[model samples]
Target: MRQLGGTELKRLHRSWRRKDSFRLALLLEDVQSPFNVGSIMRTAAALSVSELFVSGRTAAPGSPKAQKTALGTGRYLTWSTHEDVATAVRAARADGYHVVGLELADEAEPLAAMDLRRDVCLLIGNEDRGLSASALGLCDAVGYVPQTGRVGSLNVAVATGVACYEVRRQAWADAPAVDSGDAE
Candidate 1:
């Protein structure tokens, strides 16, 4: 119930860094909101995503709003921008990653059921339009976060956070247990 002191928090951060095991990337295609982009950057860093690929009209990580929302986390993430989404997807695929689109298309599967154990490049689309038809076609798979509430969807940033968490959850579940080296 007590707030963690700076020293304790630093130790916790270092411990988390040592346990980083997932190889995940993010591709934001034409996401217009700087706030959303920044928020996504923070979430990506927290989840240990290896990189971010921004394409089309998505806000750059250096944008003021993005920087503000990222709270200094933007510098910790490796990000690149492309003039087109296809180029980014192709590059990710060439690098031995599965490019999955986070969209709500009719053919999309539920996020919880998707296999994310392998290296992943998650493609996130615009706040309003979702993924472009061409972008969706390039993805190896499309997944949507299941929702039962009155709201049909979540904010783009919120959805990205949820998706990232799902990936991390799956990785953690599949990872083999290791000893911490502390004596009982």
Candidate 2:
């Protein structure tokens, strides 16, 4: 067995798009590094994020530096900019998304424990600081990625990717099985 070629990879992507039913949104709150933002944008596109909102000086995916990392995948999403996390949170909630903040807060539950099968907006904060007090207050739920490593926290981009994937994973896991007629 050999590695799948580009054609095979493309075929897989095409099939996954058909199962992309979850409504996922992301709110980047003051994630300063352009590279991080770019990487998160790539993950967001792969996981089928329907809405993206950036605020508080988070690097825009369309910026030159970010584009260097995101390539053209960032264009697959339509993201908006907001003044701050509070406003972004309000907007996300108004759009029928249950905003979940990714942080190691005192009250946060394990990320995987949350019911992410529904429409969810993940709020990620700055690289150095996890989330502002006011911003944390704005979240409908707070969740953290349970880690076994010695590291205190994950990189902003990495955490975003993991959380986004978790949301999709939950949805996919809870879905009813379909034969899809692929097997002979």
Q: Which candidate ranks first by TM-score, i.e. highest?
A: 2
Model 1 agreement with the true structure over 1-184: per-residue lDDT tens digits: 8777877766665554554466889999999999999999999988888989999999988999999999999888998888999999988887788999999999999989998888889999999999999999999999999999999999999999999988877877765553432322
Model 1: colliding residue pairs: none
Each prediction's TM-score against the native? 0.90, 0.92
In model 1, where is the ten-residue run with the lowest total lDDT? Answer: 175-184
Model 1: CA > 4 A from native: 13-20, 176-184
In candidate 2, which residue pairs get closer than 3 Å at backbone N, Cα or C atoms, i.e. clash?
A: none
Off by over 4 Å in 2: 177-184
Question: Over all chains combined, what TM-score does candidate 1 have?
Answer: 0.90
lDDT by residue (19-102, candidate 2, tens digit) is 657799999999999999999998988888898999998988789998888878987998999998888998898999999999
Global local distance difference test of model 1 = 0.89
lDDT of 2: 0.87
Give Cα-based local distance difference scores for all models.
0.89, 0.87
